[model samples]
Target: MNEVMDVIRLFLPLIVVQLLLMSVALFDLYRRVSVRGQKWVWVIIIIVINLLGPIAYFIFGREKSSEY
Candidate 1:
């Protein structure tokens, strides 16, 4: 139906963007865990805390560059 199609059109973009953001965050978490030897903690955090886990990882979990 036309109404269904309209709803899909509006919702599709938002869904796509949300998926992209989640994927990006998960990918970043994987990279940080792999590189820093912290996979178990990061995996637990990512699964248990969801979006907040990645946000925290981005803020504090990454390995700091010594050059700074």
Candidate 2:
């Protein structure tokens, strides 16, 4: 029905946004965990504490050579 289609249209963008955010978080977690000197425990931190995971990565996970 037209009403169902309209609801889907409205919800699609929200679904896309959530997926994008989740992807970014996962990528950040992988990068942080792969650091050479750092322990792998941070990956657990990221998984159990979602917001803190990315924040810790940004604060502590940056390689000396890369800005991101």
Q: Best lDDT goes to which candidate?
A: 1
All candidates: TM-score: 0.52, 0.49
Candidate 2 lDDT by residue in tens digits, 13-63: 876765555467667656552553454565555556655665565567556
**What's the lDDT for residue 17 in model 1?**
61
For each candidate, what is the lDDT? 0.64, 0.61
User: Runs in model 2 with CA error above 4 Å?
Assistant: 34-68
- Compare the candidates by TM-score and give the number of the best one: 1
RMSD of each: 4.5, 5.2
Q: What is the lDDT of residue 66 in candidate 2?
A: 54
Residue-pair clashes per candidate, as listed?
Answer: 0, 0
Which stretches of candidate 1 lie above 4 Å from their native place?
A: 34-68
Query: How do the residues 1-68 of candidate 1 rate in per-residue lDDT, one tens digit apiece?
Result: 99999999999987676556557666776555243547677666655674576666666766676321
